[model samples]
Target: MAYRGRFAPSPSGPLHAGSLVAALASWLDARAHGGAWLVRIEDVDRPRNVPGADEEILRQLAACGLVPDRPPTWQSQREALYQAALDRLVREGKAYPCACSRRDIALALFAQGRERTRHGELVYPGTCRAGLHGQEARAWRLRVPEGVVPWTDRRVGVHLQNVAEEVGDFVLKRADGLFAYQLAVVVDDADQGITHVVRGEDLVDNTPRQILLQRALGVPTPQYLHAPLVLGPNGEKLSKQNGAAAVEVAQPAAALAAAARVLGITVDPRVAVPELLAQAVRAWGARYP
Candidate 1:
């Protein structure tokens, strides 16, 4: 497959240090393997997007000398592919309609003393799977097999999750027709022919759901690597909404070099972009540590 890899960033805001860490890791891994590095703006959830944020993200990457092999791809332009994947899941009985709402599911779980849903969304009871529809509209959920989500992670060790038991049936396409991240990511990865996925650790739990979707649609799954979460000075994760500042695109070499240091690499911040990339490639090869 020639080791094709992708850096998919959501356009919620400008690139933050956390985002830069993810991008740097994926870029180094792809380059070290002599693979193609690609970019995809995951603007599927349009509500959170900032106008012009996508362009700003690309500009920041360019400043960091992390140019993708091909022109950048956008998720908003790929509705048909997502639809096809959804249709296949339904036809194969791998997914079904769910009518549970946030409140209803929460109440169901409160009765059981469970504090949170496995995916952090309310744990869905099998309320809609039996052809029973509530008063509200229905969203589609994957009929996750009653077993563990078996897989391995490059960063996290020995990954497993029983989606049926832990996460419950997860939504595929929301009632408003916006595809779930699980569905969209699987479709896009297959569509782009991604052979390896090196991203942040926050997505490690979501990997199982994605793997299920991939198997249901008969898409070849990519190798997975989840990096550590970037924490704030308060010990919380850094996020755009949490006031994490944008990666200084005006000084991208500095941003890239800083991210490398944060990831425990001993490279100098003043290294040129090209040489920094080469050093990064060598560092990544020593161990994904």
Candidate 2:
């Protein structure tokens, strides 16, 4: 575990400015720590994946002088790995079949007049945790036990979440049969021996669920640093779903500079991409180390 890190991005769209910030931060931190930096395309959910988005993302990352140590891996091609993990969870009784649809959960909450939980999203009321109520199992869910998952983030400070109470037994495999991100990411990180995760703060909540999955799967949890997100003009997190504009790949240094600024690193505009990245990496090492 020689400071291995990764930047896993979904292939829903091209790299937007916000996503570039996440990329740069992950890359810089790896370089700063003298670690192996890897890239993984999270395209397991094929329905939402945009055609050509994966190639374009790789091209964009290279343009910004952020190259993966090895050819990037794709989640879609790693089905067997995910299936093995899911099967293990099932065999151990740590996970169970779930048949409740979104509407069923929503209606159940509405019946109880409970719209949202404190952590948001219709807190699944464990409707199918027992036995799917005589219906066919449509998905699989992790049996989150009651406890507090506490961890100190390198950047965001301490975070504690009661996964059982806040999120209830969460889905491991979706009703559509796609493995959930929580399971896929945990399995991938452990398999890759990832020791550090540097990404945007928007993913802060996802950490606890991932940590729980790692514990159940007997995998090591990585150090995390949730950096500040790049917000849109409207103050919303710039996201592909939010219609955030793509980064200007024609000007690699400019895009890198913008992302560096978001990470609080100052760069010389006159420098070329390589020099710019070298300077930024040094700055990141000083700041984070």
Candidate 3:
């Protein structure tokens, strides 16, 4: 596999502090392992994508001296790949169409005397697992198997989850005719030969579902390292939705140093961007090796 790693970011906004932490961590991991570092624009959710956000994200990465080894991929242009993967799942009976909407799922859960999970995610009741029952199909969902799926995180250590019991049969294709993140990410990782994934801890919950998708699609699961999240002033995960400001790359070294601090790798912010990143790579190797 040659230790390939990637930093995939959605094109919803420019690189913010939290996103830079993820980007820096992934770049560090790739450099530390002497691997190829790649980038991918996760713009499959067309509605959320800003018109020029992808270009701005690349410019931001370049300013921080975290350029990819190859030209970045855009999920929006790869619908055929996702469709092919979904088709295989459908043929294998691992996926099926669902007619349930948000309200339908809520009502089904209520009937079963169940409430949303602690994370506030509504667990689907598999209402259309048998068939759509003549109702028009609204989306496609994977038929998650029963039993705990155990996986290890390089940073967070061991974790276990029963996808069937917890997440239920999650969507592969959404009602809006867009491919779900779970499916697009799995397919992209496999297609890109990504051997490692380094991102924020906020996405750690998504790992199990992605693992399940990898198994269903018969693709290799990459090693994961979830970096600590950078918090906002309100002590919440920093995000564009919460008005987290974009990284000011006018001073590249300072920006890179701030992100490195989140990864527990302190470096001289006064140095040039190249030297600062070099120091970061060494520190990261020592800790993560």
TM-scores of the candidates are 0.94, 0.97, 0.99
Candidate-wise lDDT, in order: 0.85, 0.91, 0.94
Q: What tens-digit string does per-residue lDDT give for candidate 1 at 1-289?
A: 7899999999999899999999999998898888999999999998889999999999888899899999999999998988888887788777887777788788878888876755457767777777654455568888877888789887667888887877888898987779888888999999999999999888887998888878888889899998877899888889998899988877766787788886677676676888877887889878763
lDDT, residue 84, candidate 1: 83
Residue runs of model 3 more than 4 Å from their true location after superposition: none
Ranking under TM-score, best-scoring first? 3, 2, 1
Clashing pairs in 3: none
Q: Rank the candidates by lDDT, best first.
A: 3, 2, 1
Report the lDDT tens digits of candidate 2 across residue range 1-289: 5999999999999999999999999999999999999999999988989999999999999888899998899999898999999999999999999888889888988998878865457788888776866799988999998999999999869999988878888988898889888889999999999999999999999999999899999999999999889887788888998899888989998889988999999998678999999999999999999
